[model samples]
Target chain A: MIMTVTLTILCLLLILCFVTTSIIPTPVGACASLIGGFLLLSFIYGFLGAHFAAVIQIIVYAGAIMVVFVFVVMLLNVPTQDLPKVKISLADILSILLSIPVLILVSIKILNWQAPMIDSQNVEMKDIARKMFIDYLWPFELISFLLLTALVAAITVAHKNKGSRYMLKEGSDHGR
Target chain B: MTIIFSIIVFAMVLIVGFHVAPLMTWVERRQCAFIQRRVGPNRVGIFGFTLFGLGQPIADAVKLLFKEDGNPSYVQPFFYFIAPLIPSVTGLAALMVIPFGAQDTFFGTVFSPQVLSVGAGFLLFFAMSSMSVYGVTLAGWSSNNKYSLLGGLRASAQMISYELGMGLSLIPIVLIYQTLDLQQIVYAQSHSYLFGFLPDWGIFRAPVSFFIFLITIFAETNRLPFDLAEGEAELIAGFLVEYGGMRWSLFFLGEYAMMFAFSGLISCLFLGGYSLPYLTHESLIHIVQPILGSFGSIAVFLIEFATLIVKMSIIMLIFVQVRFTVPRFRYDQLMKLGWVTILPLALINLFVTALVLGYSSFK
Candidate 1:
C-alpha cells in the first residue's frame, strides 16, 4: 500500500515536471525540467521492475541525448531576446486534441491494470540482450541500418558545400 | 535500521567526496612541484610536522570560502548559479554504486561498503558522469563570454566522444563477468588467479581495454592532455573564465571529486578492488583470527578498506603525474585520439576479448 502511494506520487510529480518543461521560457530551464522528468520516469520504471529500461532511459535520454541538445543550444548561442514567443495556435490546439484521446486511453488502461507482486528476481542485462537478439533481431538490425543511413546522409549534406571546391578544381582541369 | 544504515553510508560519502578536491589540490601541486624542481605550499603549515604541506588543502579551502563571490552584470544569474552544483552532485552520486570493500555481516546486520549496490552499477556511474556535461556546458553558455562558450563546446564534444570509448571498453568486462554488479565483479576478481601467481585482475585479462578506459577517463574528467575544456593558455580557464570565489571553488571540488570517483572506478574495475595480491578476505580473516580472536572479521574489513584506499591513492597519484608529464593535445588531435584511435581500438579489444573467452571456454 505504501509502495503504491509513493509510486502514484512519483508519477504525478513526473507529469508536473514534464508539463513545466513545455511551459518554461528559457531553453536551459526547459532542458533541465526535461532531465528531471526523465530521471523521475526512470525511477518509476525501476519501481515497475524494468531495471534495464530504467538504466537505458537515464543513459540514452538524460545522459547522451540531452547532453547533445545542451551542446547544440550552447553552440547556437541563441540570445534570450531572440527566443520565440509561445503562442496557442491551431497546431497547439490540434496537438492537445490529439493527445487527449491518447491520454484517456492510457488512463483507462492504467486504471484497469493490476500491479504485479514484487518479484525477488530482478531483470538482468543478459535477458534484455538475449531478447533483443533472439526476438527483436530483425528490428534491431533494421534500426542500426536506418541509423547508418541517417549518419551518411548527414555527412553528405555537410560535405556538399565543401565538394564545390573540388568541383572548381575539376572544372579548371577540364578547361585546361 | 535500513534508514540508519543509509544515513551512515551517505555521511561517509559526503566526507570523502567533499574533501577529495582539497586533498587532490595539494597532491597535484606538490607532485607538479617535484617534477619542476620547485618548493610547493611549504609555508602554509609546519614544515616537517604537517606531512609535507598536507595542511595546504585546508588553507586553500579557507581562502576560497572567504574570497569574493564575483558575478558579472551581463551573465544569466540562474543558470550560472546552478551550473557548478550539477557536476558536484553527479560526481558524488556516481560514488553510490562503487564497492569500496567486501560486504560484511555483523550483529545480524549486513553492511555493504557501497551506498547503492544496484544491478546496473557501473552503467549508473556512466549515467551520472555523463550528466556532468551539463555543468560545463551551462557554465560556459551562461557566462556570456566567448572563451567560456568555446570551453563549454569543447567539453561537451570531448566528453561525448570519449564516453563511447569508455563504454565500449567496459563491454569485455561485462561479457567476462556476466554481471553488472560491481560487488560481484570484485568478488570474481578475488577468486581468480592468472598462472597461479598474479591476481586475475581486469588489467591482466583485458590490458587494451584498461589502457583505453584509462585514457578515456582522463578525457572524461577534463584532466591535462585532454583538458581543452579549461585550457588556460588559449581560453583563460575555458568555461570558468567568469567564475570566482566559492562558485569557482565548487567547480574545482567537482573536478577532483570526479577524479576521485574515476580513480576508485578504475581501481574497482581494472585492479582487484579491495583485495590485495594473495590476500583474499577469507585469507585475511584466517590470518587475523589467531591474534585478534573475535575481532578478526572487523580487522579484515578495515584492512580491505585500507587496501582499496591505498590502490585509489596510487591511481590518483598517477593522474597527477600524467597531468605534469603529458603536454596538452591539440583540439583536432584530441578528437582524432578519441574517435579515430580509441574507439576502434576499444571495439577491437572487445572482439579479441570475446574470442579469447569463447576459445578458452571451449578448450
Candidate 2:
C-alpha cells in the first residue's frame, strides 16, 4: 500500500514536471523542470533498490550536466522569447499518429512485466563496485572510453574555430 | 523514545547550525580588527561592555532583520527568493550524517548523536555540497545584472573544478579506512596508534591527501584566497549584489554553516574524531570508572563530545585565521591551483597510498 502511494505520487510529479517543462516560457525555468524530472526519476530508481544508479543519476546528470545547461542558459542571456505558435501541421499529426502505437506497445509491455523483488534494504557500494569491476568490466571500460571520446570531441570543437578567427583578425590588422 | 531523542538531536543540530553565523560574525570581526591593530566591537554592553565585541553579531542580526526588504524591478522573483534558501538547507542537510560523538544506549535505546546515520555518509555530504552551487548560480542569473551573472558563473565553475580535487583527495581516506561511513571511519581511527605514540588518524596515514584535502576545503567553502565568486573589488559581492535584509543574511548564514559543517567533517576525517590522542573511550572509562563508579561511562561520553567540538572549533579558527592571512587569488590562478596543481597531486597521493598499503599488508 505504501509503495503504491509513493509510486502514485511520483507519477503525478513526473506529469507535473513534463507539463512545466512544456509550458515554462524561459529557458532556465524549462531546465529547472527537467532537473526536477530527473530527480523524481532517480527517487523512483532508489525505490526500485538501485541505490547506486540513483545516486549516479543525481551526481552525473542532475548535478553536473544540468548545471552546465544552466550555466549556458545564463551565458546566452537570451531575452524571454514567447513560445512558438503551435500549428497542427501534417508532420506533427503524422508524428503523433506514429507515436501512439509505440506508446501503447510500451505500456502493454510494462503492464505485462513483473519486477524482481529485492529483499535487501540497502545495496552496498562494495557489491556494486565488485560487479562493475568483475561482471560488467568490459561495458564499464567501454563507457569510460566513450566519455573520453566525447570530452576530446568537445575540446576540438571549441578550439578549432578560435585559431582561424584570431589569424583573420591579425591579418586584417597587418593589412591596415 | 528513540524518535523523541532523534528529534531532540535534530533540533540541537539546527539550532547550532543557525547560531554559528552570528557567532562567527563576531569572531571574524574581532579577529580581523585584532590583525589590523584596531579595537573591535568594544562598546555594546560594558568595559564599554563590548564583551570584546561579542555582542556585535546580535546587533548585526537585529539591524538586518529591521532593514528594508527590497526586491529589484528587473529580478526574476521566484528564483531570486528561493536562491538564498538553497545554501542553508543543503548545508544543514549535510550536517545530518556527521557523527559528533560515540554511540550510547540509554534506557534500552541506542542513540547516536547523528541525525542520519547512513552508510554512504561521505558521498551524501559531497552530493549535497555540490548541489549548493545551484543556489549561487541561480541567484546570480535571476538578479538580471551582469556582475551577478559573471559572479555566479565564476562561483559555479570554481566549485566544480575544486570538487574534483576534493573527491580525489578523499579516495585515499576511503581506501585506507575501506568504508564510507563517517562513524565507522572514526571508530577505526580510535582503535589504532601510530608508532605507539600518536593516534593513527587519517592525517598520519595519508598526509599528502590531508594537504590536498585542506586546500580543497578552503576552495569548497569559497573562503578567502578562493572567494573569487564575491570578489568585492571586481564583482561587488558577486551573486549577492541584489540580495538585501534577511535574504542576504540567509546567504551569510549558509556560508558560515557550511564552514562549520566542513570543519566538523575535516576533524572527523583527518583528526581522531571525538577521541583525544592516546585516549580512546575504553582508556577514559578505565581511568574514570574507579573514581566515579557507574557515572564513568557518562563522563566519558561528555568528554568525547567535548573533544569533537573543540577539534571542530580549532579547525574553524584556522579557517578564520587563513582568511585574514592569505590574500585572495586571481581567477586564473585559482583555477590553476584546483585543476593543474591539486588535481594531479591528489591523484598521485591516492596512487602512493594504495601502493604503500598494499605492500605493508602483503609484507
Candidate 3:
C-alpha cells in the first residue's frame, strides 16, 4: 500500500509537470527541465556519484541523443494507427507461472548468501581489474571481438547496394 | 547539527542546480559573442550587464511551464516517467564526497565538512557514475521511437568505451599515494615538492598522469571536443528526444551538478584540497586561535571554504573556456583516443608508478 501511494505521488508529480508545461509555453525548456530532473535522480541513486551518472545522463539523454529520436519521429511521420502490436500467448503465460517458483528460490538463496568480506568502498581498482582480466578475460575478449564484428557487419550491410553502382560504371564502358 | 547541515546542503544544491543552467546559457552566448567581437545581451541590465540577460532564463522557465508536454499513446508511460529520475539523482548525490570546505564546526562539535567520509570514497564515486547509463538506455527504449533507441545504443557503447580509460587513468595516482581515499590523498600532498618550498601536488609528482587524467575527465564528462553522445547536428539530442517539460529540467540539473562534482574532484585530487602553499596547517591553527577567541574555528572554516571555492571556480572556468576553444571529435576518433591512445599510456604510467613505489619501498 505504501509503495502504491509513493508510486501514485510520483506519477502525479510527473503529470503536474506534464500539464503545466503543455498548457503555457515553449517545449524546449519544459522538456529540458523535466528530463534534467530525472537524470539527476538516476545519477545519485543508480550509480554512486552525481558526477558520473549525471554527465552520462545529460549527454546521452538530453544533448545530442534525444534529437535523433525526435527527428526520426518527425521525419517518418508515424501516425496513430501504425503502432506495432504485441500478442501474449497462453504458453508464455504458463511459462511465467512456472518461472515464479524458480525466481523465488533464487531470491531466497541470494538473501541467505554471505555479504562481501571486504569493505565495499575499500575494493580497489586493481582488485576489480584482476577479476576482470583473470576470471572473466575470455568473456571480455569475446565481447570485444563480437562488438568489432558487429561494427564491420553494419558497415557491410549499409554498403551492400553501393557495390552495384561501381559495377554499373564498369558496364557502361563495355556498352560503349 | 547533522540534520541542520544536511538541510542547508540540500537547499544550496537546489539553488545551485536551478541557477547554473541559466548562468551557463548566458556564459555560452557571451563567450561566443566575445570570440566573434560582437556585443551580446547589452539591453537587460545596468552598465549593459543585462544580468547578461539573466531574465532570459526566467523567461525560458515560464515558457516551458506552459508548453504541451505530449507523449505518444504507444509509449510506455511508466518507464518514460522514471527514466529521467535516475540520471538526476545520480548527478546530485555525487556532491556527498566533495569537501566544500576544510571543516565545519557545529555548536563546538568539530566535524569534517564532507557528508560521507568513507575511506574508499573514490570507488564509491565511480560506482555511482556507472549506474547513470541506465537512465539513458531506458529513456530510449521506453519511448518506442526508432531514433531514441538508436541514440540509446550509441550512448551505452560510448560510455562503456570511455569508462575503461577513465578508470585506468586514475591508477597511477592511487599507486603513487598508496591510497584510494580522496582525503588521504589530499593529506599526502602536505609534503614539499622541491625539498622545502613548493607544496607537493599530484600534477608536480606525476605530470604525465595528470595530463592523461585531465583528458580522460573531459571524455568522461562528455564536454565538447568529446561530446559525441549529444552531437546535436547529427543525432538531435540523442537518447532524450522524446522527453520534455520538468522531466527535461531534471536532465539539465543532473548535467550541471555532474560538472560541479567533476570540477570538485579535480580540485581535491590534483590541486590539493584546501591546502595552501608555504603555510603549515598547525601554525595557522595556532596563530588564528588567539585573535578570534571562541570563534577562531569559524574564521578558519571560512578561509578554507573560500580557498576551495576559488580553486574549483578556476577549474570550472577552464572547462568553460575549453568548451569554447575545442572542436568536436569524430566518433571513430573518440574511440581510438580512448582505447589506443589513453589506455596504453595509462598502463605505462601505472607500471612506472608501481616500479617507483617498489624501488622506494626496498631502499
Candidate 4:
C-alpha cells in the first residue's frame, strides 16, 4: 500500500516535470527535466524489483547520454529569442482527435490490467545477468562493438580542425 | 536488526559521512600549506591556543552561514537553485552503499553496517557520480555566462570520457571477485590470499586497473591535474565565477564529500576494507570472544569500522598531497590521456586479466 502511494506520487511528479519542461521549453530546464524524469523512473523501477535495471538506467541513459545532450545544448548556446514559437500544428490537432478513443481504450485496458507483484526482496539480479551474458552473449557483444565503432566514427567526424598544424597526426603522439 | 534499527544505523553512518566534508576542507588546506612551506589556518581555536587549526572548519562554516547569499537576477532561478544540491546529495547518497562493518547477528537478525547493500553496489555509486555532471553543467548554463557554460561543458565531457575508462578498469576486479556486492568483495579480499602470501587486494591483482581508476577519479572529482576547467589563470575560476557565499561553498563541499567517498571506496576495493592483514573478522572474533564474551563481536565491529575509517583517511591524505605534487593538464592533453592513453590501457589490461583468469581457472 505504501509502495503504491509512493510510486503514485513519484509518477505524478514525473508528469508534472515533463509538463514543466514542455511549458518552459528552456534548453537547460528541459535538460534538467530529462534528468529528473530519469531519476523518478529509476525510483519507480527500483520499487518494481528491477534494481540493476534502475541503476543502469541512471548510469547509461540519464548519466551518460543526457550528459552528451546537455553538452550539445550548452555548445549551441541558443538564446531564448531563437526558441521555436508554440504553434498548434494540424498533426497535433489530428493526433489529439485520434487519441481520445485510444486513450479511453488504453485506460480501460490499464484499469483491468493486473500488475505482477514485484517482490523486490527476492528478485535475483543473477538471473538477469545470466540471461544477458550467457544466453544472449553474442548479441550483447555485437551491440557493444557496434556502439564503440560508432563512437570512433563520430570522433573522427568531429575533429574540427582536420588538417590544422595542431592536428593530432595519425600514428603519432601529437608531439606530446 | 530490525527496519527501525536499520534506519537509525543509516542515520548514524550518514552523520559520519557528512562530517567528512568539513574535515576534508581542513585536511586539504593543512596538507597544501605543509607542501608549500606555510602555516595554514592556525588562528581559529579555543582560547586563542590553536589546536593545529582543528577549529578552522567550524569557523569557516560559521562564516559561510553568515555570508550574504546573492540571488543574481541575471541567472535562471530554478536551475541555479537546484544545481548546488545535486553534487552533495549524490555524493552522500553514493556513500550509503559502502559497508563499514560486519554482517553479525545480534538479536536473531543479521545486520551489516551500510545504509543500503544493493546488488548494484559500486555501480550505483558510478550512477550517482555520473549525475553529478548535471550539477556542473546546470550551474554553468544557468549562471548565464558563456565562460561558465564552456567550463561546465568541458569539465562534464572530461568526466564522461574518464568514466568509460573507470568502468572498464573495474571489470577486472568484478571478474576476480565474481560478485558486484561491495560487502562480499570486501570479505573476499580479507580471506583471499595472493600466492599464499599477500592479502588478495585489488592493488596486487590489478595494479594497472588501480592506477587507471585512480587517475579517472581525479578527473571525475575535478581535482588538480585534470582541473583545467577550474583553472584560475585562464577563465578565472571558470563556472564558479558567478556563484558566491554558501552557494559557491556547496559545490566545494560536494567535491570534497565525493573525494572522501571515493577514497573510502578505493580503500574498500584495493585495501582489505575494515579487515586488518592477518586479522580477519573470524580471527578477531575468536581472539576476542572469550576475553570480552558476548561483546567481542561488537568490539570487533567497532575495530573494523575504525580500521575502515583509518584506511579511508590514508587515501584522503593521498588525494590532498597529489593536488600539490602534480601539475595541471592542458585540455587537449587531458582528452588524449582519457581517450588515447587510459582507454587503450584499460582495454588491454582487461584483456590480459581475462586471459590470466581463464588460464588459472583451467589449471
Estimate, for each residue in A72-114, the C-alpha lDDT of model 4 and write its tens digit. 8788776777767999999999998999999899889867754
The estimated TM-scores of all candidates read 0.91, 0.92, 0.68, 0.91
**Candidate 3 per-residue lDDT over residues A1-176, each given as its tens digit:** 55445544554565565565444233333444455455444433223323333444555454334444433333333343454554679997999899999989987985575422333344455565787899999999999999999999998887788647565465233211
List interface RMSDs for the candidates, in order: 1.5, 1.9, 9.6, 1.4
State the DockQ, from 0 to 1, for candidate 3. 0.06
lDDT of 2 at B272: 85
- Give residue B159's lDDT in candidate 3 (0 to 100): 67
Which pairs clash (backbone N, Cα, C closer than 3 Å) in model 1? none
On a 0 to 1 DockQ scale, where is model 4? Answer: 0.60
Better of 1 and 3 by TM-score: 1
Q: Which residue pairs collide in model 2, if any?
A: B45-B49, B46-B49
* Per-residue lDDT of candidate 2, residues B20-106 (tens digit): 999998888788888899977766653456566677777888899999999799999999999999899988888776787778775
lDDT of 3: 0.67
lDDT of 1 by residue, B1-363 (tens): 666766887788879888889888888888889999999876667555777878788888889889988879999898899999999998888877778778876556777778977666688898889888889999998898899989999999998899999999999998888788888888778865756787878888788889999999899999998999999999989999999899998998888888889988888888989888766777777788899887777788788878888998999999999999999999999999998999999999899989999999999
Clashes of each: 0, 2, 85, 0
> Best by DockQ, which number?
4
Worst 10 residues of 3 chain B by lDDT: B41-50
